[model samples]
Target chain A: MTDTRMATDAAATWHARLDSPDMDWEDFGRWLDADPSHRAAYDAIAVLDAEIGERAAAIAALLPANDDEVAVPASDAGVPDAGSASRGTRWRWAAIGTSGALAAGLALLLVAPSNDGAAQVYATGRSETRSVTLDDGSRMQIDRGSRVSVTGGGTPVIEIAQGAASFAVRHDPSRVLMVRAGGYEVRDVGTRFDVVSARGRVAITVAQGMVSVVPSGGAIGDATMLNAGQSLTITPDKQIAIRGRIDPARVADWTDGRLDYDGAPLTLVAADISRYADSPLVVDPSAADLRFSGVLTIGDGSRLVDQLRAVLPIRARRVAGVVHLDAAGPR
Target chain B: MLAANRHQLVRFFTGRTGSVAEAEDVVQEIWLHVGQPPKADGVTGEPGAGPIANPLAYLHRVGMNIVLDRVRANGRRQRRDAGYVDATTSTVGAEAIDDAPSAFDAVADKERMARLTTALTGPPEGAMRVFRRHRIDGASHAEIAAEFGISRSAVEKHIAVALRHLRKALDD
Candidate 1:
């Protein structure tokens, strides 16, 4: 066979193996690296494969139906219509909703607090991170799938309803900033910190300065002071609060699309990944105590579980659109 | 594993793309696809489920696919630019000069669609059906094979044949 023909066949074989779990990626890489023409051949095949998918609906409309095969009922859920114009319209609406939410987020930052002291709620969509600068110049970077309500004008009371956020409060002894999550309050005169409130648990990581953590109605004298590089976590059932050391630089790294964990619980990692995940991610009880210490790049939020699987001895299985992370069995 | 071998992946991509910056961009894209959802429905096996025999080689393969995607995009952009220049020079006094690019794109898309339609008809018997079932209908290879009363490899061959024909048609 001609070199071009041989490369084309090899490229086709590699493309076919793309969906295989046991795919030999290293061998495939070597094949591509062996000759530059091999790369060109593989590129054409791969791009064509993707184009076929992109134009699937259009192509389906053009082609004759598979009359001999059993036709899948249209009412079946999760199965997209092979030739539906509605799919296009749904995508258009999705695009509009994304931009609309972004515009609303910007407007929320500019709007002045109401005189009535009514709390204004701010929320971020799945896979979206938002930064808000309050009137007092204290900035809060809200993580994906999070909600925070702001009340009070000069001395704002920020409440995290769900998910995580990082704060850089302007140091002002005269005006104290209060952050509430899961019935616990963080009082700051001036500091940078991260608060994650989910699953009835609250974790506060202090990157810079000092912050006092106390119950909502607790007195200041009884509050626990968390200094820079210290993290505090309050368990849901026991209400037992534990303090630990953390890298000051890694606090709120999610704002930069990186999840830097230092021996964090698997449950906590799953909770963070759930923010960007399309389906609910449940951690198996057996894997509850597993701790993860690594840096994961959150690009579009799809591969977080994959990255976790690579480092941790965990396997993810999707059932009814929900992903479950379980400890791997002995091979 | 990806975190530990990130530097090596960058080096591999840099060697191929010839620029550290571009290599980093490709590596970033690889991270996105590393834990991607399984392509076939009801397929429980994860890509990196077990210990990879050669992790660096696996990463390099992922990087290669991303580089190919970038190359393909560049090729498409160049083709579009050449078409735009051709249309502008050939039709100096044409109406709606401002809409030339969009018009040209529409024409190109229409031509490609027609070619694909013609190519679909030219594939060998049953190849088109298998391709449509898997690609257009999103059926797994196992599902398509069962429907056709054929082996999984046969289903794959049909797909490869259909793809080869389609690629040739588009090239023309």
Candidate 2:
């Protein structure tokens, strides 16, 4: 259908659907099965819905101003606070499992470290990511599926539990920037780069300056001196090692509302999107050999699968909130 | 909506536009865009569609887009205008404006916003239920209450009460 015609039809259907008192599984199923173009239409409208949600009030002056243009989007995850860690998940978009447990809204502060401070929690939610400005005028991208409650916002002692995250440790002579993911603690003198934690391992890449990551005190995770264009892999038992440079932009794509990679392993890409996505993106174990390098929008992860299908015989289906991606029948 | 009836609508486009006439023109543009549908998705309105359950809301949104588009379309002119804004203001009342396209780019960071919305949404459980019932589920107050096992009045109270909290949290 023409874009205009499609938009009209989709909007009408959506309006009717959204207005209905009861929108059940059968209804949604019927709508989906009714046409191949159904989801395409829905996604188009979803963009508009996103537009409405963001600029509702600003547009309200044309409406009643006091009208319901103030309607908000859904919380990004199962729990409102959970989605707070990342972008929120609406009911319609809740077709994913294991959304990132995000906290709500931004908290900008010039955090100064207290000498006796304990770990304070800073978190982002599913489909949500955050960058906090430190007192040293430095910043860090808090990745999805993780929470690091540092003692002081200045010291920036965050623990990475699962998923990939990055930090641009502010350069400060007095402060040692440290991040703990599993057993490995990334200690830095001053540096900028990316960090990903998964399968009981954390990979740290230094993009600028240098860092010395030993364990918390004299305890060491195989201490390494990482400068620009270098990386380190820290295992669960605090085993640390070194490597070469990675594409910081591609790894840090989530910070910019994008999921991008260069010849990225499908399994690894799935793990990446799986962090910010409300839905879990599972790749076929058989197709683990496949490599994907492209951009996927932060919201509506099915769009990523759609992009993936353009090149490979992969299909994604949602069942009980799980989005399973497997090789399509035949090739 | 008629021009005479659009006291609120005009104000909506005012911030987007520099003048009352431009705002009115945007209102006219809204009429064309709204009565039919959007180019992208057409006319996906909600049940109550709330305050925006009319043509005017669509108009305002269109107006805003128009203004942004105008800004983009006039980038070169605006840069020149910025240089002469002081002179123009002293002469013909130009707006004291800093042309910033990057501010829009700043909106792209999901992390900072993610941290923000968590607080605005008030820990999810509190407001999400109401938001879903009211917007996504299209459920009535009675239906929502039945689902939640609260009275209809309780559901209404929930929405009413939730709005107060959201307003406070969002600080709007």
Question: Which regions in candidate 2 have their CA more than 4 angstroms from the true location?
Answer: A1-115, A144-146, A152-154, A162-164, A198-201, A212-221, A232-244, A278-282, A300-302, A317-324, A329-331, B1-172
Regions of candidate 1 where Cα sits further than 4 Å from its true position: A1-118, A278-280, A318-322, B1-172
In angstroms, the error of model 1 at A47 is 69
Each prediction's TM-score against the native?
0.41, 0.38
Report how closely model 1 matches the true complex, as a DockQ value: 0.11
Provide the global lDDT of candidate 1 against the true structure.
0.66
**Model 2 over residues B8-90: C-alpha lDDT tens digits?**
66654553344579877766544432232122322221111112322332333334444433443354356455653222211
Fold similarity of candidate 1's chain A to the true chain A, as a TM-score: 0.61
Task: Give per-residue CA lDDT, model 2, range A149-268, as digits (tens).
Answer: 444334455666566667676543334566766556666544676777765556777776655555555433234555566666665464545455566445466667777667867876
Model 1 C-alpha lDDT per residue in residues A2-108, reported as the tens digit of each score: 78766776676666544333344445545656778876777787777766665666877887664455432212212121111112221112233243232222111
In the order shown, the candidates' DockQ scores are 0.11, 0.02
lDDT of 1 by residue, B1-172 (tens): 5667778777666655656899888876554434322224222222322233344444555566557546655765576567642333222122222222456557877888778767766645466667767766767776776776776656666676666666767776
